[model samples]
Target: MHSSAVFLIEFGAIILGLGLLGRIAGRLKFSPIPLYLLAGLAFGEGGLLPLGASEEFVAIGAEIGVILLLLMLGLEYTATDLVTNLRTQYPAGLVDAALNALPGAAMALLLGWGPVAAVVLAGVTWISSSGVIAKVLGDLGRLGNRETPVVLSILVLEDLAMAVYLPIVTALLAGVGLAAGSVTLAVALGVAGLVLFLAVRYGRLISRFVSSDDPEKLLLVVLGLTLLVAGLAQQLQVSAAVGAFLVGIALSGEVAEGAHNLLSPLRDLFAAVFFVFFGLHTDPASIPPVLLPALALAVVTAATKIATGYWAARRSGISVKGRWRAGGTLVARGEFSIVIAGLAVTAGIEPSLGPLATAYVLILVVLGPLTARYTEPLATRLSRLTRRHRPDTSAGDAPPALASEGPALTVDPDTAMSGSATHMTLPPSRGGS
Candidate 1:
């Protein structure tokens, strides 16, 4: 058999496997990431059918995947939504990312990994799976009113942060040591980004001129800008994902709709390829040894993030039930974790670390959705317990009712007492009633 034909056959098989597994996972109410990983394991190296794609090709495919994913992410933006909802959501996101990540990083260190590996792992676990959380909550119709804005804001914030976070992690892992040179390079990159922002901000005038004359031209311009920025960021040793995100943010302030439409096809194609390729790269056999540690880290990751979100929501004076629901909704990790894990591998971590990270992600993806499913019942019970154990209200007895001089308004009108009263009124009710 020709090598090209064999490669095509394997790739085709993997793609079909991904779609089938995704559908199966969805029907079973499980997160699809784990299933996708399984699909990869099934057809990838060391599996039933071994693949022959070079790591270099997979790496390039992954890069394209990140960009396209970011581009699609841009399409879901609304400034008014951000302004109205992100005020509180941003803080929760920051806290969730920080608190959840620190403990995970510490755990990684305790496991005898390098600091860079630990930080990378921490960042991966820190991010919540906004896509999954929103889908679950939206399906349940719980993502409305107060919870909607908070969750939306957090999702947007996480998306934006992933841009910066991806680059930082990549640099850290790529031997950009925590020395003065690295720090200087980082600062310079930041300044360049600021300059680019100012240029794009002012360039809106030019954009208006172009958009007014021709909408298609406007889209082309935005596309060019996105690629340019994304390319420049990569040139500067920053993550292209960060650059792509900035492109979205900048274009977000102007021509966002057009930018999204222009990027959509490209993004979709890349994203599909990314997920399928991601599956191909992961090997299930590599996950067994690290299963226990990954599980422990997954537990810590879920617990800390869930608690942080709950605490943050409670501080906002939300009911305990709301806190738990919101917390559970925020427990899932997202693409950022995979991106970080990839960086970790690129940065010279032990071969085992990549598979371990994959294992960690698979566990979280499974656990995250399950948490969403059971959150309501758990929250209801917890809230009930909290109410029952309150010091202000004694258990096993109803609190005293407020005394009223007037008759009570009961649903039953047969016992009503009224004298020339046109309104429907109920009779006087007893203390028990």
Candidate 2:
């Protein structure tokens, strides 16, 4: 009973602190994620003061946070949108995978963390934070831009990929045999296909069943259904987050919008807690040694994400500015990166992996918004500056006709009367002359 009091106090304080941090972030036009993570660090195991009473509860909340994150993400798109994005943007998805995934894998191998770790890290780097990117697109008033669709397409592909990737990672981290892993992978694929099929074929019916005139009942039903599916997905060696995502995709039209509206507050609260929970597990001291590598990895992957967005937007025939905007918008990796790292941390894959991911995410999540807001303008400014500073070789240099030894007489003063006849055909002069 006494311990319960402490848990309430600790948990209440966490909520209050997150609220304050979020308020400050809003005022300053910054991401509240870094602040939330820092708060967790201060109260984490190896930090200033760890909370024993609430750690277990925080862990549970963190899991729900991930489920809600994916669920809310799914609510944004219908099965048809996902299918459309996949069809037209698959090549871009391949480019995204190649450019972004390889760096994390190389870094993992360089750190001698082996193949499993490489795969985990590859995923960590490959996915951009949809939550963060959505906010960016909204905040920057680019939601309706031409390149927005391009960005969304790449993100959808990544999310769909996670439905497969997470299960493989789970099997790998669990040290399952090839047969077991194959089964797990196959099950994940089957479930994903089944969900999409149901969504596309009978989405209206599914939504009709969940739909409610009462917001409260609607909220409860959707949330309960998501949690149930997520739990089952976990039991089947698939990711709860993936299940939650599929649940989101299954709901369409007004049902999705209503659920999104109702669940958004909960999503924000739990998502913040989720970030904190991640930080609670990552030791602050472990970050310094890995800081340089994290910084380097962040820089490399930031560029790669930008490139992925740019290339995709270009392929979609977006203008140069829109391409730059798409690239910048994709630069931020937040919740999903931490989610991937948290799994590895839980499995005890590598001790330093958690801290490295923590530092890397801290850098990028904070930088993500700024990059999204500024990347296009900055790139344009740099290009203009470069052109301005470039050496003017044209100054005091020979004219085109005069520069060539093949011609001596250039413009005919008589022909110069007409603009089109300004330049006249000229014969070569004698070499001696």
Candidate number of the best TM-score: 2
Q: Over 4 Å off in model 1, which ranges?
A: 53-58, 78-91, 179-225, 258-268, 385-433
Candidate 2, 127-238: lDDT as tens digits: 8987778777667755446676677778888987888889999999999999999999999999999999999999999999999999999999999999999999999999
Q: Clashing pairs in model 2? A: none
TM-scores of all candidate predictions against the true structure: 0.79, 0.89
Among all windows of 10 consecutive residues in model 2, the one with the lowest summed lDDT is 424-433
lDDT scores of the candidates, listed in order = 0.64, 0.87
Model 1 clashing residue pairs (backbone): 40-279, 129-332
> For residue 165, what is the lDDT in candidate 1?
67
* Candidate 1, residue 259: how far the Cα is off, in Å: 4.2
RMSD, every candidate, angstroms: 10.2, 12.7
